[model samples]
Target: MARNSADRLLRQFLLKAIGPIRRLGIPIPAKISKHLQFRGVVDVSVGSGASFKMQSHGHAIENRMYWYGKRGHEPETFLPWLEASKTAEVVLDIGANTGLYSLGAAATNRTSRVLAFEPVPRVAELTRHNARLNPSSNIEVFELAVSDENGTAILHDPGGDQPASASLRGDFLDCKQTEIKVRCVRIDDFLSEVNLSRVDLIKLDVEGIEELALRGMRTTLQTHMPTLFIEVLDARPELMAELNGLLNMGYQVGDLCSDGVIPYDLSDKKGVERNLLFAKDLSRFQ
Candidate 1:
């Protein structure tokens, strides 16, 4: 696997170069990342005995290849969840997009239920396809966006880099592009409909509209208070509401990096590094 995906200088360089652009609200990186081919359907090992099937032209494939070439991706977030997944009842992936975190959870523990939500029709299909590749894993792919409302909304497609980076929030992508209407639902409402009693872990990465999505999941957040791996793009006042809300729900938040999940401050955003892990009991995370 490493021989096929390792040291593709151009591909890795492109992904690295576009990192800043992506953080600046540009979608060009996502577009290029999707079309640039490093290899075809290479396997990615995410550590802790977990692996995933990734693609050459898929969204974030270059990054996945880098992990294959080096070590696993986001050990600060991935490793801890993997340790806990064996006993977790349910793992929710909001914006799964080809099953990065979702596939990792399922691969780590076949008994745990990994529910992946990707609103883009094609991306959702791709996620399901990835899940199928891991026959022993237990994962369910849903083709709907989770927001603060139950209805339909315009999902702006990046049109090249990948469908995984598509967004429901307007002006998400700096450049002009096309869009498709997608069904949206709040997690709280869907949980009730499905009668899910508990959710052990959640990975939320929906561009920058995460605050709105959390608003709709207030009940679920209060009930489960599941450990959350969320990415916040900006430190804007609006986005802070979401983090503050979690605090009000008796949860603590921190940045998830290679070292660990450390105390996170909104003013300390370094770049596109926005993944924050929230927990009611920090000791569980430690």
Candidate 2:
């Protein structure tokens, strides 16, 4: 049964109402959250004719559920993705936590092939479980981290229930509860190893290690020139270098907003902490 807007609103209100109580380790909010799911996962209907299967207990699942019920989440990001994938044959989603963009893309375009890469094994399995829920969607889930080089890295997982803040940054991971060694591969190397074709669109959100991931894909960026939708979190040293590297490599970077994609000025200290789009062709977005 579809949750009407009223039902969704009521659930959120209840969650908020018991938040303080729940924070005191009361477990009331958790019980309420558990009841919200019709099954083990909540179904969210994303635009372009697709629904996402989300873990009932995952991080930010509430807001994401609201968005799915409404048919889109982040319009600024989703709008461009929807547009780019119309003609895209291959799409890469890195750091695809529970496969939001990955599932969203696959749902939006049935003909497009979406590869979701998540280093966290547990999270990756969740992505797979969600993909299976959308049986008709052509989404592939991978459990390897992408970096500038091929090797293993210590991935910090903030627990399965709270995966939004997980990353490979040692400092960032240090604050988290668990650390696990994970195998990583560069986009270039992975493509060759798997014999995958050129990717037309890439959505990257690997925390502060965006530069390292980009470095590993220098060849792909130069040769394929895929459209990029990436998020830059905080003021990491790699952020500037990654932005500069994109500019040097003939890509125009912009910020996605409710209105749409706006020209990005990386030097602006205020805008460094937002989602960015890097593209060689801006016609689709325009």
Q: lDDT scores for all predictions?
A: 0.74, 0.76
TM-score of each: 0.79, 0.80
Per residue, candidate 1 scores C-alpha lDDT tens digits across 5-69 of 65466666865676566446444533455545444565666566567675545335445453332
Best by TM-score: 2
lDDT (Cα, 0-100) at 166 in candidate 1 = 86
RMSD of each: 8.2, 7.7
lDDT of 1 at 79: 69
TM-score attained by model 1 = 0.79
Evaluated at residue 206, the lDDT of candidate 2 is 90
| Count of clashing pairs, candidate 2 | 0
* Residue runs of model 1 more than 4 Å from their true location after superposition: 1-38, 46-50, 55-63, 66-72, 265-273
Cα lDDT tens digits, model 2, 1-286, are: 3668777777667656755664464433333555443224666665555665665553455444532342335667876776777777899999898787887777767888999998888778888988887888899999999998788988877785547767787776556458889999999989998788688899988977888898899898889889999887765666687678888889988888776788878887786668888899665576
Residue 149's lDDT within candidate 1 is 91
